[model samples]
Target: MPRIALIGGNARPITTAHELGVDVVLVHEEGRYEPDFADYCSRILHAPIGDSAAILEVLRPLHAEQPFDAVLSATEYAAIAAGEVADALGVPGTTARTARALKDKAETRRLLDEHDLSPIRHAMVASEQETADFAESVGGRIVVKPADGVASLHVHVVESREDAATAFKQLREAGYTRAIAEEYLEGPVVSVDTFSHRGRHVVFGMSEYQMNDRFVEWEVSTPSRVAAPHRAELTELVGRLLDVVGLTDGPAHSEFVLTPTGPKVLESHDRFAGSGAPELVRRACGVDLYRMFLAVQLGFEELPQTSPVNDHGAAIRFFTPQPGTLKEITGLDTVDALVLTVPPGEAKGNIVPLLSRTREAEVVVVITRHPGDTLPELRSVKDCSSGYVIATGKDADEATAICERVVDQICFHVE
Candidate 1:
């Protein structure tokens, strides 16, 4: 068996790694921690994020003592560091420059600007004054976020100068040296998953991502049901971006906006899509993205072709309770797939649970092949019921309706 070193071995990709029959080395302990199964080769290396020196200290001895074939990264930060390690260890990985550019929001914006691919006006701010000035210059609403982070942490849209200043102060205090403030593009957010090998790029699939009113991501559905003609244009834009960024290989997750003007690149990751997105893509289109990523890391030239397996649609909905103890959960029967964050009893407030902390809620995913899948129209609410429902369909309208219904059935309790 080929020995492979996996960084950031969390539950999301562990199952796929097990199925691939490769050695697994977990880099982070944020999720469930455990030893490898007796049948599979696995180990836990105690190295946390932001401590690249320690990771090297531990892996250096192992590289000298054992013969590992390749090193793969399962997280954004880890992947950025792995690129540097791969250079030193003579292994295949993303270039450190590319990784850094992808990981840092400010750097990404600069690159896009240089390539003339940036569709919206953007600025990097280090202080409240700078944020206000940029917001004024842009003239429209602005979206602000940490220069480098994931999961939309500290992401907020500022409708006024006051909001911009407050957001900047909070982010600066949180140790984010700078934040990117860009024009808030109006339209649906879409996630495009793709893989590249030796300059050959393939778009695994595209999904329309839905978010709650508060800007928390809800779910993702394939063959984006927003508009039909936007698919090809989005794919071409992604390909052009890959070429511009000089991203030659590995798995990539790119998020963009299907605005009235055109597709605007929100950001891109040189790693596999997170949030069980890889699995969702696999179900919608018969592509094992995780497996393909491993192949690229190992210098494979081609990936297996895949087609949609089922005509029916699939979706995953996330759930969060009101600002109180998570007493219980109900109404799961309306969905097909589910994952929970808070157990039956736990204190929950504001749904701003830290990613490094415990899982605060669960996800209920749904899939159906029913023809003309029509869901009851839903009225958007303010609190209690907060989350996203990911759905796919044969056409955009069918998928949109299912998503609306899934959103409606979700209800929450807090006291």
Candidate 2:
């Protein structure tokens, strides 16, 4: 069997690779080991966190001993490492330039603007003053975020210089010295999942998001209700954006907001969509995106034609609670039967630790909340999530109804 070097274990890419009769060698950061991977992974390699040099040192010997067919990563943070390893080994995968652009928001925006694919104005600012100036220049309202982040962490919407200054300060204090101030574009957010082989684009799915006040996604529904024409337009636009960013092979996630003018690219990454989206796509299209990504990288020329597996809708709703001491929760049995559910992935406890206090904490609170726990102080997504509710229905409305039913039936009591 051919071997693939997987750079992260955050998703079920290992299981997918294994099921496809491919061997996955799991490489992850030290102290972040996942025992679940042992069953599917052939070997486990570790390197210092955020140290690509150390990761390369680790992969070199492994490659020499047993040549890898491809280097793969399904996580945003590890995409660059995957690219570097692939380049060194002359394998099929993302290029170093594309991976770097995906990791740096400032670079992505600049590239998009240069290509005339993105109309929004943005700047990478170092200090609160610079952020304030950019906000003023962009008509007072701006979006501020760390130059490097994932899953909406440390992102802020600012309407005034004060908001910009405050957001910039919080970002710096959080150890991110550089931040991007962007023109706040308003619209519904959606994710476009695409596959490319040597620059040939194939768009398979688009998922719509319901976001909270802080712009954190609260719920996600796949096979977006976007009209056919608009969907086609979005498909064309995203394909061009991928080419602009130089994505040559494998899977990529590109998020966009449909503005009054048209669909504008928000951000793009070379990975499968996070937040339970793989299951969503599977429920909608019957496509194992993780597996397909690996197969394409391993040089599969003709893939199985993809189409909707069902007309029914699939949705994921997060369980977010107010800040208070945990008391009890109910409705597990009732909520569990609603649909195929991926459990809200944490254990319940007496006092849920608040993850962070920044603006991100508000959305992050709900982002991380579990289904059946009491959170005394809801801080960030990391500490407050109790669980998530996944549902499938005959249509989008029906799917939403199932999710809503889960919400209505499940109860969290805190004091």
Best by TM-score: 2
Candidate 1, 1-415: lDDT as tens digits:
5566666644435555676665665555443343332234466666775466766776777788775687677678586777776667776667777888888877887777788885568888888888888888888788888878676667877878789778887887878878888889988888888888777677777777666655656555665666347877877788877776778888889998878887789899888765556655655665667677765566443564433343444454444434444433355565543533433112121221122121122224322111122221122222323334545555444655665666566554333
Worst 10 residues of 2 by lDDT: 350-359
The TM-score values for the models, in the order shown, are 0.80, 0.87
Least well predicted 10-residue stretch by lDDT in candidate 1: 368-377
Candidate 1 lDDT score at position 22: 59
lDDT score for residue 369 of model 2: 42
> What are the RMSD figures for all models against the true structure?
7.3, 6.0
How does model 1 score by TM-score? 0.80
Error of 2 at 237 (Å): 0.8
